[model samples]
Target: MKYLKTRFQWIRWAVHIGALLPLVVLIVDALSNHLTFNPIQAATQRTGDTAIILLGLSLACSPISTYLNWKDAVRLRRTLGLYTFIYAAIHLWLFVGADYGYQFNYIVPEFLQKYYLWVGLPAFIILLALAATSFRGAMRWLGKRWKRLHRLIYLGAILAMLHLALVIKGDALRLSGDAWKPLLAGIIIGTLLILRVPRLRRALLSLRHKPVAPAAVQLASPPAESTLVKN
Candidate 1:
C-alpha cells in the first residue's frame, strides 16, 4: 500500500495489531467459555474495556503525530475511532440483550440507581455522535463544526473513566490487579490531554528538529547594532 510508505509505517502497523489484539483475546476467552463465571457480565465488561481503550488510543493519535510528526497518524485515527465504535456498539448490545434480556424495565431501575450508569450514558451518546460523523463525507459536510464535535472525545474519555472508577464494587485504588486498570486508564487519558496542550505540543514537536549546525558554524558574530548605525 502506498500509504504504508509513509514515515513511521512500523508504528502504524504496530498500532493496528495492538488495537485488534484485545478483540482476539476476547474471542479466545469466549470460545473457551472462560470469559467469567457470569457470561453476560464478562462479555459486557471485556467489550467495554476494549472500546474505552480503543477510544483512548484514537484520542492519542493526534498528539502522537503532533509530537512524532508522523503525518500517517492522521490516517489511522479514523480506523482506530471506528474500531472503538464497533466495540462500544457490541458492549451496549451485550448489556441490553444478554445482560438485561432486552428488558428496559429492569435496566431503567438499575440506571436510576447507579451513578456510573448515568455518567456512562452521556459518554456513550457522545461516542455515538462521533462515530456517526467519522466518515470523510461527514467531515466534508460538517467542515469546521467537525473539529468542534470530534473534540468531545475528551469529555467522553473523562466520563468513561469516571464511569469505570465509580462502577467498581470495591475500592478501585486498592492494591490489586483490577484496581490498576482504571488508574492506568486515567493516567493515559491525562497524558494524552497534556500532549494536546498548545504550548506543550509545540515544545514536544520542537524536539524533532536538530540544531542547524552548518548555519551556526557558517555564520560569524555580527558587530553591535550601534556600530552599523555609526557607519
Candidate 2:
C-alpha cells in the first residue's frame, strides 16, 4: 500500500516535470544550433503530433484506471489533454506566421482552393474552440453544455488523422518523411475507437466480473507500557 501511494506521488511529480521538458528541448536545441531544419515546420509538426498523442492518452485514462484500480491517477488525464492544446496552439501559430507570414492574401487562397486545407483548417478551428473551453472555469460556466462542446475533440481527432494521412500521401517518393508515422497513428486511433464498440464493451465487462483477492492491510502494533500506579 505504501509503495502504491509513493508510486502515485512519483508519477504526479514526473508528469509535472515532463510537461516542461518538450519546451525545454526546443529551446535548448535552438540555443545549441542543432535546430537547423525548418524551425516553424518542425514546431508545427511536433505540436500537432503532441496534440493527437494527448487526445489518445486522455481517452486511455478510463480503461487504464479501471485495469490498474488507480482511480486517483485520473487527474493526470486532464493534464495530458491540456498539454495537447498547448502544442496544438503552438502548431497553429507556426503554420500561420511562418507559412503565411500572417498575410491574408496567401493564406486566404489556400483555404479556399486547396483540398487538404479544407480538412486541416476546419480541424484546427475545432481544436481552437475546444482548447478555449478546456479550463475548469469554462467547464463550470458551461455546466453540462461543456460536455457537448468538448466532444468536438472526437471530430477534431478524426479530421487530424485524415489530414495527416492526406498530407503524407501527397508525396509518395518522400518516404523518408512522416509517411509511416501517420499510418501508425491512424491505426492506434482506430484501435481505440474499436474498443468502444458495444460488443467489445460487453466482453470487457464480463472479463472484469471475475473475482479478485483483497489486498492485505498492514498495521503497526502499539508499544506496551507498564505503570506502578496500581500498587
Candidate 3:
C-alpha cells in the first residue's frame, strides 16, 4: 500500500506537469509571435481543445479504474477536472478578453450570432460549479449530493463536443471539413459514458477480480511406491 501511494504520488506529479505543459507552450508561442496569423484565435482554439481533452481524461478515470484495477486513476480525476476548468477559463478569457477586448457590446453580439458560443456556455458553467465544489470542504458540505452534481460533467462534455462541432468550419453531420476533431471527441466521450453504465462497470470489475484456474498436477509412476514399501 505504501508503494502504491508513492506510485500514485509520482503519477499525480506527472499529470500536473502534463496538464500545465500546454499552457506553458502556448505562452511561449505567444511571446515568440508564433501563434499564426490570428494569435487570439489560435490561443482560444488551443486552450479550448486542451480543456476538452482534459475533460475526457477526467471522465476516463472511473472506467480505467474499473477495467484496469488501477485505483489511483480515480484520484487523478479531480486533478484532471481542475485542469480542464483552468484551460476552459483561459479559453473563455482569450475569447472575451484578447479577442473581443472584454467589450460586452461586442461579446454579446457575437454570442447572439454564434450558436456555438451559447452551446459552450453551459459547459463552462458546469465546469465552474464542479471546480468550486471540488475541495474536501465542499465534498463534506455536499455529501451524497456532490456526486450527483459532478455527474453533470458528462452533460458538459456533450455540450462541449457540440460547441466544437459547430465552431469548426465543417458539417459534422456530413463528416466534411474540420468535423473529424469533434467527431472523434464525441466517439471518445460516448465510449467513456458507456463504460460508466452500472452493468458494464460491474462486469468489468468482475472480470478484473475473476480467479484464474490452476493447472492440474500429474502423478509419477507407481514403481516408486513399490520401492518405498521395503522400508
Candidate 4:
C-alpha cells in the first residue's frame, strides 16, 4: 500500500512538471528575447494554445479511464483542468493587460468589433466559473449541481475552438493559413465528446472486456500415435 501511494505521488508530480514546463519555457523565452517581433502576440497565442490543449487533455481523462481502464487518469483530470484555467487566465491578461494596457475603451471597442472575442470571452467566463467551483468545499456545497455545472466545459471547449478558428488569418472553411491547428483541435475534441456518449462508451467497454474463445484441440495426433504403438 505504501508503495502504491508513493508511485501515485510520483505520477502526480510528473504530471505537474509536464504541465508547467510550457510556462517555464515561455518565461525563459520571453526573458531571453526569443518570442519574435511581436512578443505580446506570440505570448498570447502560446498561452491560448496551451490552455486549449490542457483542456482537451482534461476532457480525455474520462475516456482514458473508461476505455483503457486507467483510473489514474481520472485523478489527473482536476490538475489538468486547473492548469487549463491558469493558462487561459494568463492569455486573457496578456490580451487585456499587456496588449491593451488595461484600457477598457480600447478593449471594449475591439471586443465589440471582433466576433472571435465574443465567443472567447464566454469560453473564458466558463473556465473561470469551473475553476472557482473546483474545490472540495464547492463540490460538497453544490452537491449534484456541481456535475451539471462542470458539463459546461464541453460547451466551453466548442466555443474555444470556434474562437481559434475565427482568429486565423485565412478562411477556416477553406482550411487555409493557420486553420489547421483549430481544425485538428476540433477533430480531437469531437472524438472525445463522441466517446463520452453512453451508448458508444458501453460498446467500447464491452469490446474491451469481451472474452476470447479457446482454440479447438486437434485430437487426430493422439489416435495416430496409439495406432502406431499397437502395430
Point to the candidate with the largest lDDT.
4
Q: Model 3, range 104-190, lDDT digits (tens) per residue?
A: 998888889999988899999999999999999999999999999998998999999989988998887798998899999999999
Residue-level lDDT tens digits of model 4 in 3-59: 644598888998899899999999999999999999999999999999989989999
Best by the TM-score measure = 4
lDDT of 2 by residue, 1-231 (tens): 347666987887887677768777877876777666676666666667777777677666665565455676567877776777677677777778866799988889877887766788778788778777878899999999999987776788788887777765345346566687677787887676666667886676566553433331123222221111111
The lDDT for every candidate, in the order shown, is 0.80, 0.70, 0.88, 0.88
The TM-scores, one per candidate, come to 0.80, 0.77, 0.86, 0.87
Runs of candidate 4 exceeding 4 Å displacement: 1-6, 211-231
Name the weakest run of 10 consecutive residues (lDDT summed) in model 4.
Answer: 212-221
lDDT of 1 by residue, 10-107 (tens): 86778789878888888888889988788778888888889878888888878756665455667788888888888888888898887789898999
Mark the regions of model 1 whose C-alpha exceeds 4 Å error after superposition: 1-18, 206-231
Clashes of 3: 0
Clashing pairs in 4: none
Number of backbone collisions per candidate, in order? 0, 0, 0, 0
Please report how far candidate 1 places residue 172 from its true position, in Å.
3.3
